[model samples]
Target chain A: MVMPMDGQLLVLAQAETGNALGETAPTIEVEEVGEPNPLTADEQELHATTEADGDAHHSDVFPPFDATTFGDQLLWLAICFAFLYVVMSRMALPRIGGILEQRKARIEGDLAAADYSRKKTDAAIAAYEAALAEARAKAQAMAEETRTSIKADIDGKRAQVEQDLARKLEDAEARIAATKAQALANVDEIAADTVQALVGQLTGEVSQAEAREAVSQVSKE
Target chain B: MADPNTVDPIHQFAIYDIFTLGDTGISFSNSSLFMVLTVGTIAAWLLLSTAGRKIIPNRAQAASEMLYEFVANMVRGAAGTEGMKFFPFVFSLFMFVLVANYFGMVPYFFTVTSHIIVTFALAMLVMVVVIGYGFARHGVKFLKLFVPAGVPGYVLPIVVPIEVISFLSRPVSLSVRLFGNMLAGHITLKVFAGFVVTLGSLGFLGVLGAVLPLIMAVALTALEFMVSTVQAYVFAVLASMYLNDAVHPSH
Candidate 1:
């Protein structure tokens, strides 16, 4: 058992003396001066016969024990407990508490960071949505402008085609009218010639006056 | 060292009884002395080690500094960096128990470790304190220490009782491991030493037998020394494990 330093030494010294110098020796006195006391007859026999490593003075540490009572042991245990509590409260717990408080603060700091991140994330999401809406509006306007320009281009192309078709149709009608006038002129000329010929034939057959009248009437009609 | 046959076993085994209080009894013996010594030794060690210090450590300061670092790292590694919060309590418990165990192993010193009562008391203390800490930290949520994740309602009938029993058995198992190891080792040593005496009284054959036990005893003593340190460490580690469970009840 671990004894108090001052204490075990005293018990050890007494045990050594009794074993080495004999319990019966009269001249031996164990001085506190760290020297072995003189040995006596009975002590010398006990020491020699044992043949124990009697050099280490503390070898006499074994003391008699009786196992019946426990009041003192309980008292010692209680006292030791008190010491333990004191050390725990005064030194150990304070260091532990400081570390714990530091940890709590660190956790709170992280939570605050998470909160800040959430807010920042919300702002980023809002800004992205706004940009998306603005982009949609711009695209819609651009599409509408393109559709208007395409409609204008189609209208211009249709008007140019219609003007070309009308010009061709007018030219075709003028040609047809000219051909009909020429045919009519030729027919009238042919009829006048035929009448003249017939008058000549009648005069020759001795009917000049009647033939002349028929020709004039035919010409007039 | 007495002859095995000549000496009375009861006399040799008798532990000193110092007092009586009515129906109660209190004994101051080798065991009691060691307990007192353990407390004193721990106090002196802390004080002397910290007596003179430099901002940047010298040898003595470095020694204590290493102890602190060792314990801090142990807490961080076993419990997690978050375990640093429990650094002080766990460190002190480790140092105290380890030192006490070492002191008990000294030649001719009465080993308080070989007793179940002492070990159980320590285990119970850790169990109680850890539970209390959990309650303080988590309030009603401390009940989650046993209710593991993903257990369905149908399974709760069988699982809850089993978990509760396992939880309560922590102190018993922890104490028994330490007590049984220490007690068995010391008893083995004593028995082997007895054999040396018994066999040595014969002639040459006796001497040969005695030689074997002598060798065995010496070897076992060395083994015992290692076991003592390991047991102390085991106790401390278990304490930390229990604390971890308490803090992280989700597990």
Candidate 2:
């Protein structure tokens, strides 16, 4: 029975200790003996020890709530925070803000410059293309002019050669006509001579005039 | 059972004086040291990083610029373009709280924002600015913030008081939110870390069992870091929203 009672006391003590500090142990003897009157002298002594420990622990106020530290904390907080506020507002913040502002301005300026450069480049390219197109058109016109002039020169030379050849052909036709008329006249004279020779050889000498007259009459018939 | 002496979680929050001014009750303490460090760090980071003022920023300059733009955009988004007048004030508050919270994350370093007085003062400062700016800018028209435009006339009484109450509780909530987060997060981390120490003392078996708590402590440390950053951002966002009321108090 005594052993069981001791076991119960140990269990109660352990339970209380565990509640105070979320860990279990058998070492905290009789932390809060619920029934003080039923306690043995040994249990009472253990309770006294536990009470002393609790007093020692609670003697100092919880540090967060300690009124004595309030003045110091408030003073330092004011000094540090005010100093920080002033430094930040007056010096540090403005500097950072300025840096950011400058960076933004620089970026914008660079972008604007880039945009201007791009526009200039576009204009230059457009100008170059325009000049190239104008040059191409000029070259086409010059080539057409050159070809027209060359064709006119060739046509003029061909017309002169054709006129010379036609004149030469007409002159040759006139000469052939003249030659034919001369040959016809010679043929009449030669016929008269042949008839006169035949008459002289066959029927006694006849008059040349009379043979010519007969031949002429035969040609007319 | 853990030894109470070895696992006293609240010991870390204690403030001890480094030097005290004679009889005036003003003393330099650990909290003061951290506050100074916080301000110094912010100043140096902002000032030194941007000293070059390069058109293209280096890594440090970019980081500083990002912090500036982040807070700037938040103020603008919450309050609008007219609220740019309060940019410096909002920036200061954001940096101080953010750097102080991060400073607290370093081991063995005091957390300036974990104290209720410090956060309360900051919240009050914000409220004062809001009220002062609202009244200065709009006169009695600032009271229009409490009166909703679309509310039916019969429900004005109930709705107005509720708005007034919520408006009055802003500083309390603001201060407590940051303080509580910092205090509770630090306490939780300390408690979990204490478990590892307490469990690791029992011998080879205890060492093996301690691994679980050790893992928990590491995870909690990561959670605490997130909590610190998030609390700082929340504080800044809320302050911006409140400042918006000063700029446009017509609900």
Candidate 3:
């Protein structure tokens, strides 16, 4: 509120405060304010002679500063607010979303790699076991083959030796038979000679037939 | 008649209330009508001005471009590049407050800003939004705004509380400054004006006094205009500062 033409300070006109007077001015210019900005002498002398008598000054009731009663409700109707919020969240948000999704995917991809590593190791382990098993089976098969070949060689050598021994034995048997036959033939001749000798001692020489007969009679006696 | 507030400076404003709705207190006054007028004017200006935009825009489009650039440069300059994010908010604030203030000087329309209800409301709204935004973005980190950079171990008992008080008083001081400036300016304008009419019949001295008051009235009006724009800029800049504080609370 503005100051009055009179040289009095306003006593703050109020609607309901007890200390405040109504529309009417208070009795005496109480601490009156005017061109004399209660703070200065130059302003005071400027309006020193304006008001006369006991009136001293003319003052108006000043309004109190109502901090509580601030702002018009209409100004804050929040008109179009919902639409603005939606625009900001929807249209504006999508532009910056790539980073968030990328970060999530990167982390998830790392996790997937970690998980995949286990499976890979397990597969490699299985492959390694399979390779090891194959090697063992191959060695066993080789050893078995070596055993069977050695046994076959030994059996072939034994069969050859048996055939050679049989041949030798047969030859030996033929030789013995020849020798015995020769000996028997010689015995007869020898016995005939011995008988001839005995005859000579007694009476003189005998024929071969007579000798064989004498040998035979001597054999009988 | 002798009351300081006897003459309402804006009474002559030709805008008037056409009717009232059964005392529902929802009566649309001249001021309310003009507020709508301001909003519509801005909308039309934006739409029509930008209707046929081109790479090298025509006059209408250029006008829109200038306005946009003006707000952009201001935001960039005051709030830096980071402030660009709040361009829409600052731009809207400037347009609304600028229009209201310029229109208030139109010799008839009521200055909505002259009322504490308007200025304080805007201040509080900004505060709530800024605080809400910081919390939404950084959660509890916003509380660090009250924490100072350095002090002493012993001073914590005193410094922390004082800093907390200062932070809490932000909205109060902001609203009060704007409200007080507008209110005081209008009151001074009204007071000087009363002299012109009341100094009647004092002859050449009266004429001389009337002339001095007239000159002062014009000068003050020009000053008020400057003040209106300044206040809007200050309000916008402070809002940016608050945002910066939220972004870098430890600072």
Candidate 4:
């Protein structure tokens, strides 16, 4: 029986007191302490003498069939275990669980917010690209319209300038023609006078009609 | 110098009554004191660590959270998600056993787990929970746990009794494994320590001889610490396994 035999158990109880002295004394004191509790000094001596006879004490830790302390140990164990269980299940574990849940929820919420913000950024980029394309198209159309309008304005100005130049040329040509005809008439009169002088000098019988007819024929040619 | 033979290696495991109830035989003993201390320390450490409840945990909080997650993962792995319902029980058992085992390593302190009675009680609690939950959840079908699937019906008579005995022995095996490991380790440590004191007393050569045992004691102490932690982990893992069996009786 793994009985907490009085002798063995007393040795345990006196261990602290045994520590007070030198190491050697403590070891010897431990044996004496075990004997003193169960019997008077006289019986202890008898028992010590028996122990000294080298009969090994029934010191097997797991001695056969000892039921003495089982009741008290079981009772205490149940009490302690119950207390521990209640505290753990009711209070401690739930708190940790709640904290973990909170952390998980917080992480999920942050991820969701990140996802939402990312989507908003994508939408904004898309809108910006659309606006940029529309602005490019509008600028292109305005440039085409401006180029056509400017080309038309230049064409109209060129046409009007050409017409004005043609009119000026025609007027100048008519004036020049008139001047030539007047000069031709004067030349005929002078020629007639000159021819009559020359003829008188050369052959003193030239007629006025002959000079006029020569001048007229030359003018006609 | 004290005689070396006087040092009792088993002295540390003895229980002493600090205060006794009148005629009831029920008393507050050293074992009870350490048990209370173990629970109190666990409670205080966990509560204080989590008091701030910050999203970003502080050092103390981080340590506590690590332990929590470790045990949590252990349950989830062994028992699956459904087994998580019993997290509190498993966590409590793990922490209590772990704390008690480590606390035993402190010089002159009592080891609550070293006692067979205490370990047996804890084991019984696990067995009770497993059986109770199994029946509660599965009803008569829980008996199917003992009957292996795809077995010849002729083998039922032989296998059923063996399965029942194994099932019944779970608590015994569980309790004894922890108790035996702790008891043996502590005894071995005490015996080696006794060698240190005895050898040192034998004069010059004796002191030289003491060094070897001292070194071995140090090495064994390190081993014991590992054993303590591993045993606690094993206890929790086994409990979770049993709970898994309970939750899924068909397997």
The ten-residue window of minimal lDDT in model 4 chain A covers A47-56
* lDDT (C-alpha) at residue B139 in model 2: 100
Please give, as one word, the docking class of candidate 1: incorrect
By DockQ: ranked, best first: 2, 4, 1, 3
**Tens digit per residue, CA lDDT, model 1, B137-172:** 898899887788899988987888999999899999
**Sliding window of 10 residues with minimal summed lDDT for model 4 chain B:** B16-25
lDDT of each residue in A116-159, candidate 4, tens digit only: 99999999999999999999999999999999999999988888
Index of the highest-TM-score prediction: 2
Model 1: lDDT to the true structure: 0.64
| Candidate with the larger lDDT of 1 and 4 | 4
Q: Which has the higher lDDT value, candidate number 2 or candidate number 4?
A: 2
DockQ of every predicted complex: 0.08, 0.31, 0.01, 0.22
TM-score of chain B of 4: 0.97
lDDT (Cα, 0-100) at A78 in candidate 1: 58
What is the Å distance of residue A96 in model 1 from its true position? 13
lDDT by residue (A37-107, candidate 2, tens digit) is: 34444433432232222222432235675444565677788899889989999998898899999999999
- Per-residue CA lDDT of candidate 2, range B86-204, in tens? 88888988889888998888888889888887899999999999999999999999999999999999999999999999999999999999999999999888887787887677778
Interface RMSD, prediction 2: 9.3
Instruction: Give lDDT tens digits, candidate 4, residues B1-251.
Output: 14675666776776655665665546667778899999999888888888888788889988888888999999999999999998999999999999999999999899999998788889998999999999999999999999989889999999999999999999999999999999999999999999999888899999999999999999999999999999999999999999998998877
RMSD in Å for candidate 3, one decimal? 19.1
TM-score against truth, every candidate: 0.54, 0.84, 0.52, 0.81
How far off is model 2, as Cα RMSD? Answer: 10.6
